[model samples]
Target: MKTILITGASRGIGRAIASKFASGNKIILTGRNKPMLNDTAEYVKKNGGEPVIIEADLSNPQNVLSLTKSIDITQLDLLVNNAGIAVVEPLAEMTLENWQKTFDVNVTAPFLLIQQLHSIMPKGATIVNIASIASKEGFPNWSSYCMSKFALDGFTKSIREELREKDIRVINIYPGAVATDIWNSVPGEQNLSEMMSPESVAELIYTSVAQPSGTVIEDIILRNLHDF
Candidate 1:
């Protein structure tokens, strides 16, 4: 069975992805909160898959690096760098601390994880970066989040190009307006119920990873059809 590793697998889209892939694979689930991470791991266990739960905050550079230090696992079939944070605030009023945290989680963490873990990912392995629609289009009061996602897009594309001689697939997926709690934290936001569900995005993530190795789908943008 393939060994798939996913970050932020505690709740929301992360938990949903874990459930979908746990059907017939080895899953390594990582997140900061121990209680919630254990719950996710239990679900994976019940689904007939082994779960390696790693509890670490991605915001800390050391924690991100330390995560793979002791891990002896090699030859990863898939890696989903899905742990990210978004701080919604006006550019002028955005504090340096908030911006740094957002960048650390959304941009730097993923880059570092992929850099450190790439050698173990054999040919035909896949990597998916969960970028947002904000990566391409900007929204007000979300400068830091938008910029970080844009950087993720570039990073994903660059990785794809750099590994052209290999069989590994690098993909970027843009989930537009998912019904995740990230919206709840948005300043003065209202009517979140109008957005899409996390399960929908999770389904897409599963399908993306399950695709054939020889086939490379560069980018995918999922949006609510009703919004069109």
Candidate 2:
């Protein structure tokens, strides 16, 4: 069975993606919340797939290492970098601490983990980076989060180049205004029904993973046309 590792599997698009692939694939779900991770694990197990749940604070460097060390599985067929945090504020008002925290969770942790696990990700493995439309467009009051995702966009391209000969596919997804908790955390007028659903984003992720080895969809921008 193909082993897929997904960070932030506790909620949002991450949870939906886990449910989509959990029926037939072996899933390794990671998040900072243990109870939520266990919930997803139970759902996956009930659906006839084996799921290993791991709890780690991705913002902590030591925890990132610990998480990697705990994985005894030699190779991961798919790795989804889905864990991220947003500290939205104008550049002038954004504190250094907020900027660092955003970078730590959204960019640094994923890079560090990928660096440590690169060798263990065998040839033909697919890497999916859950980015944002902010990665491509500058959004007001989203300076730190935007910058982090932009860095990830660059990292995704660079890594793809380095691993081109090995046939490892690196795909970046820019999801726009998904109806998830991340939006609820922000103070603004948001129409949940008008926004893109997590399930739609999850389906895009599933398609990217299930494609044949020869077909690599490099990038995708999932947005609600109504919002645009």
Candidate 3:
């Protein structure tokens, strides 16, 4: 069984991805929510996968380092950097604390994880970053979110080349407005029904990473049929 690690696996696209790959694999799930992480662990167990749930505050660099201790001896096959946060407000009103928090989870945490876990991730391993369309285009009040994702975009691109010789593929997925809880607390009402489900996004991510060893889907943008 492949050893797969998914951050933010407690819910949304991360949870959906866990369900998709749960048939037979070692899924390492990490997030801040213990109860919800346990629920995801149950799903993995019931579906025939070995599940290891580690509660982590990814915003903390020290916590990211501690995750290496819990990883198994086997090489990590896939690393899904899916944990992220956003502070939605006018740019002028966005606090420094919120801005730093956004980048801490979205960009810094993933960088630290990849750095710490680099030794265990053997050649041919895939790293998937769940970015958003905002990474490419800016929204009125999503400056902090967009900026963080944009940084992730550049990080993935640079690493994609750096890891090329090692045959370690880094795929970046830019999915448009997924119907996730992340959007629920936003100020205005949204057409959640018109948004793409986290399941579909998870399917694509799994498919991209599941490609044959030599093949790599470098960058992809996923969007719903109807624009909101």
Candidate 4:
């Protein structure tokens, strides 16, 4: 069975992706919430996948390093950089700490993790970064979040080229606003019913990863039909 590692797999899109892959693969889940991670592990078990849950705060450099050491990266078939954080505030109101924290989780952690794991990754391994439309557009009161995703997109492009010789596929998924707990941190009313469901995004990811070895689905953009 293919071994897949998904960060922030305790909830939302990450959890949905785990469920999609659980019936056939070994899923390694990482998140800061031990209890929530356990819940995801239980779901994976129920779905017939072997689950390995690791509680990690991606913002911590040491934790990122430890995670790589804990996993058998050489045997991994997929790595999903799905962990991220955001701070929604007017540019002037944004704090330095918040901005740094957002980048630490969304950009820096992924960079460090990939740097450590890529060397050991098999030639056909795939790396998927779960980015957002914010990576391509600037949004008011979302400067920190936008910047982090932009950095992530840039990183994905660079690595895709660098790993081309190794035959490792790097995919960046730019999804529109999805109904998740992330919106709880943003101060405003949102049309939850209008947002895309996490399951749709998960299915999109699974489809991209399942493509034949000779083909690569480089990028995918998913938006709610009603949003247009």
- Candidate lDDT values, in order: 0.87, 0.88, 0.89, 0.91
Tens digit per residue, CA lDDT, model 4, 1-228:
888999999998999999988997899999999988999999899989999998889988888989889885457789999998879999888999999999999998899888988877787889999999999999999999999999999998999999889889999999999998899899989878889999999999989988886678998889988786
Off by over 4 Å in 4: none
lDDT of 2 at 165: 79
* Candidate with maximal lDDT: 4
- Arranged by TM-score, best first: 4, 3, 2, 1
Q: Per-prediction RMSD in angstroms? A: 1.2, 1.2, 1.1, 1.0
lDDT (Cα, tens digit) per residue for candidate 2, span 14-37: 888888888888999999888888
In angstroms, give how far residue 100 of model 3 lies from its true place.
0.4
Better of 1 and 4 by lDDT: 4
Given candidate 3, what's the lDDT at residue 168?
90
Alpha-carbon shift of residue 108 in model 4 (angstroms): 0.7
> Which scores better on TM-score, 3 or 4?
4
Answer with 2 or 3, whichever has the higher lDDT.
3
Give the higher-TM-score candidate: 1 or 3. Answer: 3
Candidate 3: residue 176 Cα off by (Å) = 0.4
**What TM-score against the true fold does each predicted structure earn?**
0.96, 0.96, 0.97, 0.97
lDDT of 1 by residue, 61-110 (tens): 88989987846697788889889888887778999999999999999889
Instruction: Tell how far residue 1 is off in model 1, in angstroms.
Output: 1.5
Q: What's the residue-level lDDT of 196 in candidate 3?
A: 92
Show how many residue pairs clash in every candidate, following the order shown.
0, 0, 0, 0
Candidate 3, residue 68: how far the Cα is off, in Å: 2.5
